[model samples]
Target: MKSAMMEREGFAALVLRLRSEGISDINLLTAVEQTPRSRFVAHHLAEHAYSSRTIPIECGSFLEGADLAVRLLHRLRIGAGQRVLEIGTGSGFMTAVLGRIVERVISVERYKTLVEEAQTRLDQFSIRNVILRQGDGSNGLPGEGTFDRIIATAAFPAIPKTFTEQLVHNGILMCPVMVDDERCVMVRLTRTGSRFEREDLFEVPYLPLTPHIASYL
Candidate 1:
C-alpha cells in the first residue's frame, strides 16, 4: 500500500497543477483526486493519468483529461442535490467526479462497448449514482427528466435543440462547439423561462459528437 504522506503529496501536486490552469473549485479538485485518473486509463498509460493528456479508450473515443473535465464542471457550477447530464461517459472518470458533487448523473455514450467498460470502471469505485446509458448522446436523455446542469465531453458542430429544451429553467449547459471545420470553442448556454443565453468560454479540441450509434470498436 502507498504511504498516506505520499498520497497527500501527490494529491497536493495535482491540485496545484489544476489551480495553475485556473480550475479554482476546491471541491472539484478534491473529487478529481479521489477518483484517481490512473484507475480509468489503460494499463500502459496509467503512469501519465494525472497529466493533461487525452488517452484512448476501448472505442475510438478519447478520454478528456482531468484539466478539461475540471474546467467544464467549474463552469457548470455543479451543486449538491442537482441533477447533471453528461454527454459522454468515456472511462466514467468525469461521471465519477460529477457523482461525488451532484445528486445524480445521467451519462450517455454512443458505443455499447464503451458504456459497458465505463460502467465496470464506475462499479470498481463503487460509484452508484451515475446512470450509464448506451445511445447517441447528441440528444440528451429525455426520460430522465430535465437537468440542473449538462456537460458535453465531445465537440458538436452546433448546439442541439434537444439539449436546450431538456434543460430546466435557470439551468446551464457547457459544451465544446465547432466554430469552423477545424476550430472549436467551449460555450456555456443558460436557459431561463424558454430563453437561452450563450457565452463562449475558450477554444478546445475534441472529437465530434455523433448522432448515430458508433459502429467502430
Candidate 2:
C-alpha cells in the first residue's frame, strides 16, 4: 500500500504530466489537486488512481483520466455561477470538478448504477451543487432549462440537435465526436444566434453515447 506521502507525490507528478500535455489552467490543476482520484476510481484500481489514465467503472463506462478532464474543462472555460450541464456522470470525478468551479452542474447518466454511485461519491465530498439523474443524456436536460455550458463525456457520431438547442446564445458545448468507427475527436461548438460553429480540438477515445437507459441491468 502506498503511504499518504507517496500518494501525494504521485498526484503531484500527475500534475506535471498534465502541464506537459498543455493543460495550463491553474484553477483546473487546483481542482485536481483537491479531488482525490482514488475516491472516484474502482477499488481494484485504487493503487493506480493517481496515474494519468482512464479507468473503467460500472456498465463499461470509463472515468476520463486527469489529462482529458483538465482538457475538457479548459475548453469549456466554465466560470463561477455558470449553469453547466454534464452528459455523463460516470464516476462523478468531472462532476465534482465542475461543482467546484461552476454554480451548478446537472449531470445525466444512462446507467442507474452509475448515477447512484456518482451521487454517493459527490455526497461524500459534501458537493451539493450537482443534480444527478438517470436518463438518456443525448437528449439533454429539458426541464432544467438551457445552460451556459454543456459537456458530454461520451462520444457521439454527431452533436445532437437537442444539446445545441438547449444552449443559450454564445454558450459552449464540448463533446467527443466520432470521426470513424474506431476513432473520435473532441469538438467544441459555440452557439451563435440560431446557429452553432464547430471547432475540432483533439482526438480522443470515449464510449459511444447511446439513447437507451441501462436501468434494468
Candidate 3:
C-alpha cells in the first residue's frame, strides 16, 4: 500500500543518487535497487537504510554506506558468472547485494551472532547463492579454494598474503588499506601469475580488519 510505495520511491531515489555519483553499471544499480536494505538493518534504523551513511549493526561493527559499497563493487567489475569472496559480512547488506550480482558468494564474518542474523536475512530474501561462514575473515577461507573476485569490507595495514594467494589467476581483490597513521585508501590487486598488480583507488574511512574469531559479541 502506501508504505510499500514509499519504500519503492526511496529506493528509486537511492539508485538515482548512486548513478550521479559515478556508478555506471546498470546491473549493479539494479541489484542495489532490488535489495531491500531496510531488511538488513535494525528496525529502528530502517528508515535511514537508504541514506548514504553508515549504520551500526551488532558486534560493534558498522555497515558501510550503500554508495561506498556500490562504488567498490563497480570498481571490482563483478561479472554474473564469477564467484566472489567477501571478507566482512557486517550487517549482510553488502552480502545480499553481492548475492544478486555474482554467481556465488562465500562471505566470512568474525562474529557468530552476525553470521546467524545475516543468514536469516539472506534466507528471507531467498538468496540461495550466498554462504555465510563464521570465522576469522582475515584468513579469507584458504581451505575453500580460490575465488574469481575477493573483496574486504574493512581496512588492513597491508593486503594479506593469505588473501592474495586465495585469488585465482587474473582475479581481483578490492580492499581498503592504511596508507599512514591517519588515512586509509582503497586498493585493487589483480593477480597475474606470481605477481599482483596494485592500484590505489581512493581514500576511505573504513575500520581496520581484525584478526581471530570473536569470543563473544
Clashes of each: 0, 0, 0
Q: What's the residue-level lDDT of 41 in candidate 1?
A: 76
* Cα-based lDDT at residue 42, candidate 1: 76
Off by over 4 Å in 2: 1-3
Give the best candidate by lDDT. 3
Ranking by lDDT: 3, 2, 1
Q: Residue 180 lDDT in model 3?
A: 88
Count backbone overlaps in model 2: 0
lDDT of 1 by residue, 62-170 (tens): 7776567677778899989999998988888889989989999999988888888888878888889889988888788877779999998788988888889889989
The TM-score between candidate 1 and the true structure equals 0.91
- lDDT for each of the candidates? 0.83, 0.85, 0.87
lDDT of candidate 3 over 102-130, digit per residue (tens): 89999999999999999998898899999
Of the candidates numbered 2 and 3, which has the greater lDDT value? 3
Candidate 1, residue 108: lDDT? 90
lDDT of 2 by residue, 113-213 (tens): 98888899888989898899888888888778899999998899888888888999989999899999999999999999998899999888787887878
Tell me each candidate's RMSD, in Å, in order.
Answer: 2.1, 1.6, 1.5
